[model samples]
Target chain A: MHGKRVGQWNGERTYLLCVHCHNPHSPRFKPIKPLPPPQRPSEMKR
Target chain B: MSQDPPCTGACSGETAPDPSRRTVVQFLAAGAAVASTGCSLESFFRKSFRELSPAQVRRYIAELEGRYGRKYGKTVTVGTAGPMEGVKFGYGLDLSRCVGCRRCVYACAEENNQSRKNPQIHWIRVLEMDKARGVDVNHSDIYYDAAEVPRPGHFYMPVQCQQCDDPPCVKTCPVGATWKEKDGIVAIDYDWCIGCRCCMAACPTEPGTSTGPSRTSPPPK
Candidate 1:
C-alpha cells in the first residue's frame, strides 16, 4: 500500500503510506515542549 | 400657525423622514458588526462543504486562497479533493518496533497545516508504557523525557484517529459538521462546525479531536 495510487476519482493522488510520515528506524513521535496553558481572565492586568 | 411652535428638535415639521437615509445607516451598522467579528459576510453565510455546489466550491476555494495568501504573504492552494472509489484506508503499527521517538507527531502537525504557535496542536500522541503494567492506559505517560528512547523496561504506543467503521464522533456531531468519507477518512466541515466539541467527548480514543481557538487579532502585514 506504500506506493499505490488512489485512483481517478481523487485525481490519482498517491496514498500516503506509513513510511511517508514515519522513519523506518524510529517510528515513534518525538517529544515536544508543551505549550503554556491559557491565562485566566482574572490574571490579566487592567 | 405661529411658525409651528418654533419646530422642536424631536418632531419633524413639514418634512418627511427619508427612508433611504435610514436604510444606509442600518446597512453601515450591520457591516460594522460583521467586520468587528473578523469574519467576512460571505464566509459567515457560506454553505457547508457537502452542501456546496461545484461552482460555489471553486469560488470559495479561490476566496480562501486569496485570503490565506494575503495573510501569509505567499500563494496558498486549498485543495478540495474527494475520496477515490473502492479505496478504504487503514493503518497498522508494530508495538515491538516503535521506539517512541515522536517524529510522526510533528510530521502530522506540519502536514496538516496546524497552528505552530499560541496553541500548538498535535493529532498524534505517543504514550510511554511500562512493560510490567502491560497496556494499562492509566499507567502510561505521555510526558516521558528519557535521555534516549525505548526506556529500558518500557514500551511506546502511539494513538491517533482510528477512522472507525462506525465513528461515534460523526454520530454525536449536532450540526453534522463531521462525517466519514467513502474512503474511510473522517472529515470535518470547519465553516459548519459550531465549536461545541461534542466529537471530542464522543471519541473512544480520548483526545482524538481537538479544537483551536479563534483568531482574536488580524494577521501581521
Candidate 2:
C-alpha cells in the first residue's frame, strides 16, 4: 500500500520494494549548525 | 423682556449629565461580536488552493496585486499557473566535482525570491562532510567556513527537496497545505497553509527547509 511506502518502515524491503534514503522513524535531517549564506563577491580572494 | 428659564429634562443633574458607561460597554461588545463573527465566517469559508475555481483564483490574484501595488507603489501582477503536464521533476548532483563554494545555494535563493533578512529562507543547502567518514550526515557540517573551499579531505553535497514518491511532509500536514503533485514534485499552498510548521517538522531534510509564512508580524497596512 502507499501508506507503507510513505517513509514508514512497515516491513523490510523485499523484491517488491526498495528502501528509502532516510529512516522511517525519526526522519529529521538535522545539520550540525545552521548553514551560512554564500560569500559575497567582494569577499573572494583576488 | 423677562427671559423664560431654560428647562433641562434628563440633563437636570447637579453635575452635567455624562454619557452612560453601559452605552460604551454595549458598543464595544457589539464591535467585538461582529469582529469575531467575521473572522469565524472567513475561516469557515476559506478554500484550499486546489479547491479554488479559476474565477476565484483570478479574484484572489487581483486582490493581492492591488494590495502589493499600493504597498510598493507599483503594479504587481499576482499570477498562478498550473504545473506543466508530462514533466516529472528530479535532481542529481555529482559529489566528486563539488567545490563547496555554496554558489548553488545562492542561485536557488535568488531564483526562488527567498527573504534575505528577518527569517531568511534558502531553498538549497550545501553540506561539507569528511571524506574519511564517507557520507555520515550526523558528522556532516554545513556551517564550515574555511579560507578556501574544496578543502583537502572533505566532500560537498548540496541538498534540496527530494520530492519523494510518498512525501512525509504531505503525510504530516494537518491543514493539507502540502501535497505531492502528479509530476512527483511536492507542492505547497502557502495561502492554504496555516503556518503550523508541521510540514517543516516532518520533512526529513534540513530542519527549516519547508517553512510556511511568517506569523510573527502582520503585513504592512
Candidate 3:
C-alpha cells in the first residue's frame, strides 16, 4: 500500500498470477457447465 | 508481416481475400504453438519441460536450476520435494499517488526477465485513467508523454495481479499451473501455461492482459 500497488491470489501454499488461473495448470480444471445463479431470497415468491 | 505497415482503419488497399477455412485453421494452430513456446517461461509451473513426459520433470528441473545458476552467477536450490501448494500474495493500489508514467511496468519487465524483443510482457501494467472515470483501462495509454499534470484531471494507476484471497483464476486452472508462493507472489511456470486463455477470462482487472517478452537491454559496457 505504501509503495507498490500489485496483489496476487492466495492458494494456501502456492501463489497465483493473472495468467495462472486464466491460463490453467492442467486437466484439473475442466470447462464447467454453467449453473443458474443462486436464487435470491427477495426474488422468491413470498 | 513485419514488412507490412501496421494496417490502419478502413480504406487500406486490400488484396484478393483468400480468407479460406484452411487459412483460419492454420492461423489458430500457429497461434497455439506460439503460445506454448512463449509459456516456457513458466518453467516451474509445468509438470514437464516443453511438454516432455512426466518422467523428464526431474531432468528438466535440473537443467533449469543449472541455467539459473549460470544466468545469475548463483545456485538456485530446487529440491526433489514438490512445492507445497496453496500460497498467495496480497496487493493493493492507491490510485491517487500513481503518476501513470509506467515506471512500474518497465520495472516488472526487467525483474521478471521478460523477452527483450517485445517489451510488453510482464507482471505490471500502468494506466492513465480519464478524469471522468478513473478505472477505465482499455483506452488509456501509459505511453503518452505529454508535459502536463492530472491530464486536466488525469490520475495514474499501476496494476498487476490483485492476488485475491479467493482468486477466480486459481479456481479456474485446469492443471494447477499457477500457484501462490510463501512470500505471497502468485507466480506462473511459463512452461505449464497452455495458452487456453481461461486465465484472461477469469482475471479481475478491467481488461485482463498476459504479458510476455522482456524489455530491451542496454548496450554492453
Index of the highest-TM-score prediction? 1
Question: Please, what are the lDDT tens digits per residue for candidate 2 over residues B1-221?
Answer: 12222334644766543345545554576567757767653454453113756666677788889899999999888758776687677756667656778777866666666655455556777878889999888898767877666677888888888887888888989888788878777788776777787776777776454464433333434
| Candidate number with the higher DockQ (2 or 3) | 2
Candidate 1's residue-wise lDDT over B61-86, tens digit each?
88899999999999899999876677
Query: Candidate 3: misplaced stretches above 4 Å?
Result: A1-46, B1-89, B136-145, B180-184, B206-221
Predicted candidate 1 versus true structure: per-residue lDDT over A1-46, tens digit per residue: 5633475643756676567766856855554443222233344332
lDDT of 1 at B217: 26
TM-scores for every candidate against the unseen true structure: 0.55, 0.53, 0.44
User: What do the candidate models score in CA lDDT, each in turn?
Assistant: 0.70, 0.65, 0.56
Q: For each candidate, what's the DockQ? A: 0.10, 0.02, 0.02
TM accuracy, model 3: 0.44
Window of ten residues with lowest summed lDDT in model 2 chain A? A1-10
Candidate 2 stretches with Cα past 4 Å from truth are A1-46, B1-87, B214-221
Interface RMSD in Å per candidate, to 1 decimal? 7.3, 10.8, 22.3
- Evaluate residue A24 in candidate 3 and report its C-alpha lDDT on the 0 to 100 scale: 39
What is the C-alpha RMSD, rounded to one decimal, of candidate 1?
12.0
